[model samples]
Target: MEEEVNNELPLPDIEVNSDVPRGPFALLNRYGNKLKRLSSKGGENSSKSQLLSAMTIMNMAEKVLSQSIHEKRGDVSNLVEAFGSDYADYLKRVVWLLDASEKLTKRQYDEAEELLVLALSGSLEGHPIETVLTFYGKYLQEKIEVERGRIDLERKVEHVDIEQAVMDLKVGVVECEQKLPYSQISNFTGVQTILDSVAAAERIHFIDFGPKFGSYWILVMDALARQGVKQLKISAVFSATDSVEETGNLLTSFAESMNLPFVFKILHLDTWEFKKDHLQLEAGETVAVFMKFCLMPLSDQPNGIGALLRGIKDLNPLILIVIDVEADINALDFAHRFKEALLLTCALFDSLEACLGRGNHYRKIVEKVHFQEVICNGILSEDGGFKRCFKIDLWRKYFAEFGLVEMELSQPSMHQARLMVKGSPSWSCCTLKMNGKSMIIGWNGIPIQFVSAWKFHYPVSPAIDLFILH
Candidate 1:
């Protein structure tokens, strides 16, 4: 499959299809009309459902146009003509990504490279979203190189080091409030459900696998703070030594501020050494295990993921909540990973335009750089622990293997999640789904991330949410 990718295939010769799309004109119009309606309509603002409709239409249009962008060819007019310069710039980048992703799947390396170059040409240097695309471009181009026999498939990022990832979790600090994951977590009903469940229990032993900055704890603490918990004890797994003290301090301060009875521990361990016993748990206590944005690192370790699951089974936590980006980044096949990476990142990048003003310099940087690093790591690099992520289905399989069954998230949880989404900016478009025992969050219809809650024994009916442990 990698061989199909032409490391240096030029853009398909511009050939105007007798049936060109007015080329992205439909989506352009849909976005503009919706924007105008939402901004112009006073008091009686457009509904979220309507906003979602616009976003879904725009996304679908892009996907359709992606497949036939080559057909639009030279006759393509200025995007600035239809939409203003701002929207035009966004469309250009979207087209470039769609073009590149579509071409990459078709193994047109040179053509994809041209689009990538075009996207990279301008002041994309400082943008996080652009940085993400850069990583995607790098990974895809590297795949072409490896297939061309220029480099080995096992190349790793030379200096893969941990940064202050948890710094953003600081309450009231709006530095990275526009982050997509925050929305996913806050809007994730499973989180609220788990917290509410534990709040009633006598004791809570919460184990986090890879606690990045203990932000999950902060979020959890925030929720607990709101409702007031009886007693809660948390065990955080801090991978970076530098973050250990800070995470502890912040969590301690947060618990005190919230006035919740909280005691916690931070376990610092590296990937190769993750052990089943490492996840400390009391034999008799209501326990919950959390792995939010942390599992991907250990995924590449041989037999490591299996051992981690086995350890989880031994603990027998009443509830296991796993939340991560919804993509099959672990797939070895280049084309499959590329498509997943492209679609997922596009959805995320598109979603952020809500809180941040369109063409907001800060947002562009966050999307280009920070999130880019994440997407690139997941989809591109074959080694150096850059293996990206997997969706909820795979996680369900793992949990099932450990004799755990999927528990339907409570309707209350779903309602909470729904409220959170409704509470966000009216201009933002996020869709939530609850089918059987699964909870998913998506940008438009494309599932960007998902959350799954599981347990040893699930009641046959979804109505049986509350029960005694014994």
Candidate 2:
């Protein structure tokens, strides 16, 4: 049976030319070669190979349609028919997405809406490109609605129940954490860094900038209990709309169950309003700040990220931990942002498919609630919302500008990440690498998320006193 299957889908042996023009034929040929190479190692059923094949077909359909349009040809039927019946449904959907994208670029709202509707009507449920097509189709629909003034983007977005959305998002995140290693890598590395930083301190003051789920702090609290720390205070800062009281209550209960002397403080304010005094800091306590998946929402605000970072600097915590998705989706141009979002989503969906069964309920929830929101807000939101993820290099520059220097993640953190990846057969393809002082968790060679630690760059005069005190 295996031999027959391999024979039916034999790998191609095409010679790819580096100087070939990026026309329809050349693009298709290159992607075909890519598919062949990917499948030769992992077999035809590998998630990466399947995704690459789908992308190749979509690109071929898009290129042909685009070329026909630019040449003033009226009919795409003949061009699409050349791919034959095997890909007819998939090609039709891809062509519709391409057409909708062109219409969106041209500001033809009605045409774009019609094409998006048509593209979304059919079922591509188990297909590799299903999530990508659905996200792009819905994004285009949102764009058309906004463009036609049929809906107010800000008003529509504001009407969503923030608390309920946060709760749903927390559930989705926990689901993903169970099935994949990215979140585990981030949380484990973060907890390890915090413990190493405050190893000698009798009292610990952990300030979390965005404690939407507060799951990471549970790990911190458990670890502190095991280490025999005397007192632990967790000050959770939340945007006014987040479910602050619930998260605090949950953490307080967990801390009590562990018999850890815990103090929970809540600070509800905008990120720009963060200040040292707001934390109600006490003397003789080691301080650490955790910003997990929080800063990206402020990327669209005018100097909002800088202001927040400056505020954190003023607090001068012993260590600051940041864990965020790695992507370059902050471009100003709509088309550029769209392309970046598509690539990111494709990689994400491919990773999910690799790790979870097709009908897994949690996987479906994560894709629908968490990633769908990410795609929509990242592309369609005027304010960038929760999806303005930027690469770690850009984040490093941001920290440097605000007087924070990168602290190399300890060896144990790297080991913890490796153990998590190796523990699960589903996570076999997950890659962990150290980039400079940061640790990156990648999927099939594409960096998906990163974990980095930072500290205030103290001057020589005060460095001695600070070093001695901690």
**Which model scores highest in lDDT?**
2
Residue runs of model 2 more than 4 Å from their true location after superposition: 1-88, 108-118, 150-163, 168-173, 240-247, 382-387, 458-470
Distance from true location, Cα of 300 in model 2, Å: 1.7
In model 2, pairs of residues that clash are none
All models, RMSD in angstroms: 13.8, 12.4
TM-score of 1: 0.67
lDDT of 2 by residue, 424-460 (tens): 5556667776677888777655667889999989531
Model 1, 323-429: lDDT tens digits are 66676665555545655666666566555644344444455455543465555565556543555476776666555555678876644455444444444454335
lDDT measured at residue 76 in model 1 versus the true structure, 0 to 100: 29
Q: Residue 120 error for model 1, in Å?
A: 5.2
Which window of ten consecutive residues has the lowest lDDT sum in model 2? 1-10
Give the least accurate 10-residue stretch of model 1, judged by summed lDDT.
1-10
Alpha carbon lDDT at 31, candidate 1: 27
